[model samples]
Target: MKEILVLYYSHRGSVRALAEQIAHGIHQVPGAVARVRTVPRVSTVCEAVADDIPAEGPPYVEERDLAECIGLALGSPTRFGNMAAPMKYFLDGLAGAWVNGTLVGKPACVFTSTASLHGGQESTLLSMMLPLMHHGMLIAGLPYTEPALNETRSGGTPYGASHVAGQEGSAALSADEIALAQAQGRLLAGYALKLAVAR
Candidate 1:
């Protein structure tokens, strides 16, 4: 079976919600499975430490996950138009994966959630792609052919999957957002399976 990693960081549970939806879509593809993981949070206070295993949710991701996964679905809430600090911190630790080309030629996609409609959803998505590009992964975005991209009133983008959590973070993912996220996962999984077979 081919595994696709669904890695994310969520505050207020919005990004995690999107991650779960993306995993749902990955499982739809035959021979593809989702390996869900999360990163430990960062803190301003010096020497803040976390347990080896999280109190809940998936296990903390290791560099090995990148090499093992045929595809990757990365998610983080928008923080000033970029992925949140913890997610970026996790990516920064991937220099070993970069030097070794552990993720080279793998399929990857990004997703994000924002507190406002104008909050940096697209920019956040783009920012997340930078590190993956350095690793030589093929970036997949939601194509316009997906009906949600054309019709979504909330969160959906050509860059990747997204959600608008509103200022109070009250809004659940709209239907279109859900559809687009699932479609992006399906697209990534299909590509990974095909590429793995070719290799």
Candidate 2:
């Protein structure tokens, strides 16, 4: 079985919810498994060391996960229309992987959560994609062919999967958001499976 890395830094659990849905979709495809991981929160004062293992959901991501996974799904919460600082800090530290081409030729997709309907969901997804693109990973996006892309009133986008968390960050994903996210995952896994053979 090949593993697809589902990596994210969720602030209010919304992005994490999307990551889980994406992983669920990856599982639907045979021969593709999800390796879910999360990045630690960053400190504004100075660099702080997080516990080796998180107290909650997924474990913190390691550089090796990028090297080992056949594909990637990167998710994050929107902070001023971009990915949160923690996710960006993690990506900024990947120069070694960039030089080694650890993620070259791999398939990747992006996801995000925003506090408002127009809270930069697409921009956040695009922000996360930039680093992956620099790493030479092929970006896989949600196509309009998906019915949910046409039907969603909440959070589906042609750029990627996304969710609207509302002000208190308590909004649950709508059915359309769920379907679109899962479809993105399956699409990414399909690309990974086919590309692995070519490589």
Candidate 3:
């Protein structure tokens, strides 16, 4: 199987829901599988550390996952028009992988969730893309062809898939959000398959 890593950092489960939908879309491809993973939270104190295993959800991402996957689906909740600290912290530590070209030429797509309509969803997605681009990965985005992109009133972007979780941060995805996310996944997996063959 050509595994596409569906990696994310989610708080309050909104981003996680999008990741699951992206994985479902990846699975729609015959030879593709989603390797779901998450990153540990960054601690405020210098001495604070996360457990080796999380209490729930997907396993923490390893450098090996980057090397193994043929493609990537990156997701995070928005933080001040950017990706959350934990996800940024994880990406910042990947200097070794960056040098080794562990992710070079792989296809990548980003996703995000926000607290309000103007909560920086697109900026968050774009922020996630910078590091992937630095790694020499090809960035993919939703096209106008996806009906959801045109129809979504909640959260969807040509830059990536997104969701608007309301002020309390518990809103479920609208139908269009789900559709666009799945389409983004399928598009990413298709790119990965073709790119893998080309490589």
Instruction: Please tell me which model should have the higher lDDT, number 1 or number 3.
Output: 3
Cα-lDDT of candidate 3? 0.94
Per-residue C-alpha lDDT of model 3 across residues 1-199, encoded as one tens digit per residue: 9999999999899999999999999999989999999998887662276678898999999999999999999999999999999999999999999999999999999999998999998888898999999999999999999988888899999999999999888748999999999999899999999999999
Model 1 spans with C-alpha error above 4 angstroms = 44-47
lDDT of 1 by residue, 65-127 (tens): 888899999999999999999999999988899999899999999999999888999999999
Cα displacement (Å) at residue 88, model 3: 0.4
- Total backbone collisions, model 2: 0
Estimated TM-score for each candidate: 0.96, 0.96, 0.97
What is the per-residue lDDT of model 2 for residues 2-90, given as tens digits with 9 covering 90 to 100? Answer: 99999999877899999999999999999999999999888854345566689889999999999999999999899999999999999
Q: Candidate 3: which pairs clash?
A: none
User: What alpha-carbon RMSD in Å does predicted model 3 have with respect to the real structure?
Assistant: 1.2
lDDT (C-alpha, whole model) for all candidates: 0.92, 0.92, 0.94
